[model samples]
Target: MKRGVRESIAVSAVLLAALFILPLLVIVPFRSELLTREPPMDETEGEPFVSGDLDSRTVLKVKNGDTVEEMDLGTYLVGVVRAEMPASFAEEALRAQAVAARTYTIYKLQTGGNHGSEADICTDSTCCQAYISEERARANWRKNANDYEKKVENAVTATDGETILYGGVPILAVFHSSSAGLTRAAGQVWLNDLPYLQAVDSPEEGDTIPNYYSRAEFTAAEFKEKMLAAFPEADFSGPVDRWLKNAVTDSAGSVETVEVGGVTVKGTQVRAALALRSACFEWEVQGEKLVFYVTGYGHGVGLSQYGANQMAADGADYKEILTHYYTGVTVEPYSFALPG
Candidate 1:
């Protein structure tokens, strides 16, 4: 009877252990709700604009930013890039750039030159590139350090979608540029057909071109003086207009034509016109040429991706960086799943 009791006790202990272990098995298969669910939408969408290809130029019209300007293809040519680039990447980069340039131009033309339906102020990095979190950047660096070549030959490419409705018009190849994490060729600051804004003395190997001054660059006194000196013609009641107020080049002065990598650019705005360069940024009037060292890149209208990355690294949140660049904007969801 005692032996029988001992066997029964041992069996009961084994059953208890099995019961405890069973719960763990169930827990092991169950993923956390946060991990399993789709991540919350990136809080960058305010006024959604479609970047599309019309005619042959690639273009984007943001809600509050400038109208869709034709993207240039020659800017990505092999010899054009100022950075030290690998020889293998030249052909692919050139080809991809050409295709994108042409596609976007077509999109603009098709939509009657618009990309946003409303003038909703953009408040997030969607109008530009998204800021990668510190942990994310570190993880990316670890995975591809010195070897993550976004160069066309090895990188995976994707289109935002084939068609997007910009201002209710159906457009083709309406996609986004540069993934949220990587800076693209579009981030390069350029003016005219030149990749680097050239100085009259000539550009050195490492000098930053197109250097424009930030508002902080000017003290209240210096700012007043420069504004007065720069535009003595009058009207200083508001902000000093730094960009091209009007086409500096007249109808006759504009480039009647432009050739990109042996292919001709097909838009009107991308003519071989005198675009502001380093000299233009400084507003220097030399020999009837508008010369000033310009700062930053692109149109100076959108989120500066490099600037955004720097801000992110400096511990500024994405919202702060977006607000700094895009004035008077609000944040919202900008998912591609929404029907246009």
Candidate 2:
């Protein structure tokens, strides 16, 4: 070959060699980092990705009557946040409620709900979470309808498709109105000993909530009748002082067990029989009436709404509030697509 041609061929071979070796030199040392590197997450948005095609509809059976309705998940969540949590709550608190309600609804959908016949969930706060129609919610809001509705909708929108998860599964996401000063363990209130439902400090449940403290008064006859109805075998023939004895309570001052009329009974039984506000209570017999002073307003099993509001006021966002309430959990986007 001519000298010029030979030189050109040598240059071409060198270029080919460089092309073959360059990628290996750059990629081998950083292979692990590249493979393990997660996509850049939007700090403001939190989750890495949110599925747009996830099923966002649910069937709700309203307990007022036999009315059954289906609505978009976001819309249902707005109503739930309005009905379940006070509209006066901070925006971040409302957003936390929205995520919790969404997680609960999704959990019901995944696991068969209590209402087995026709609905995935119910509007009865006793059975499920309290829910109301948008019209009803607006009506209840009355003068504050427009602003409150906008606030609730904004909360739902801000945390759209977010849920609390443990071991990659949606959590039960139970919540209540308020707490005495701390939340209760799931096992303390119910049968299940859920790791994520453990007790946590909730110091923000101050006296601001209207129902934070309540009292129920019952005459001796009335109390006897109710208790006897629940525990028919109990002997109520003794004095009222001896009627209740050996009261055992939890760390949060919630009644756990008590001896009533020589029969052992759970505090839950007494609370249910008397229609008391919460299991955390103290009772005293005053002359002709037995009065129960209840410190909290609900079962005290999970997140406290008043506490969440206080945390939000203290500058914690929705995710932080949820993780604080639900121990060993993460707030993440719904990972699965709903059935068509």
- Model 2 — which ten-residue stretch has the worst lDDT? 46-55
TM-score to true structure, per model:
0.25, 0.80
Clashes of each: 32, 0
- Tell me how far candidate 1 lies from the true structure as C-alpha RMSD in angstroms: 20.5
RMSD of 2: 20.7
lDDT of candidate 1 at residue 201, scale 0 to 100: 16
List per-candidate RMSD values in Å: 20.5, 20.7
lDDT per residue as tens, model 2, 1-340: 6999999999999999999999999999999999999998434331222213332433344334487765556666766788998888899999899999989888877887777666666778877778776678767887777678778777887776788999989999999888878888988778878999989988665577787789999998999999999999889888887788888998878888899888998888899999988888898989878889998878887789889999999999999999999999999878544454
On lDDT, the candidate that comes out on top is 2
What local lDDT score does residue 66 receive in model 1, on the 0 to 100 scale? Answer: 45
lDDT digits (tens) for residues 119-208 of candidate 1: 212212334212222233325445442232233212112222222223333323212211112212211223233211111111111232
Clashing pairs in 2: none
| Full-model lDDT for every candidate | 0.31, 0.81
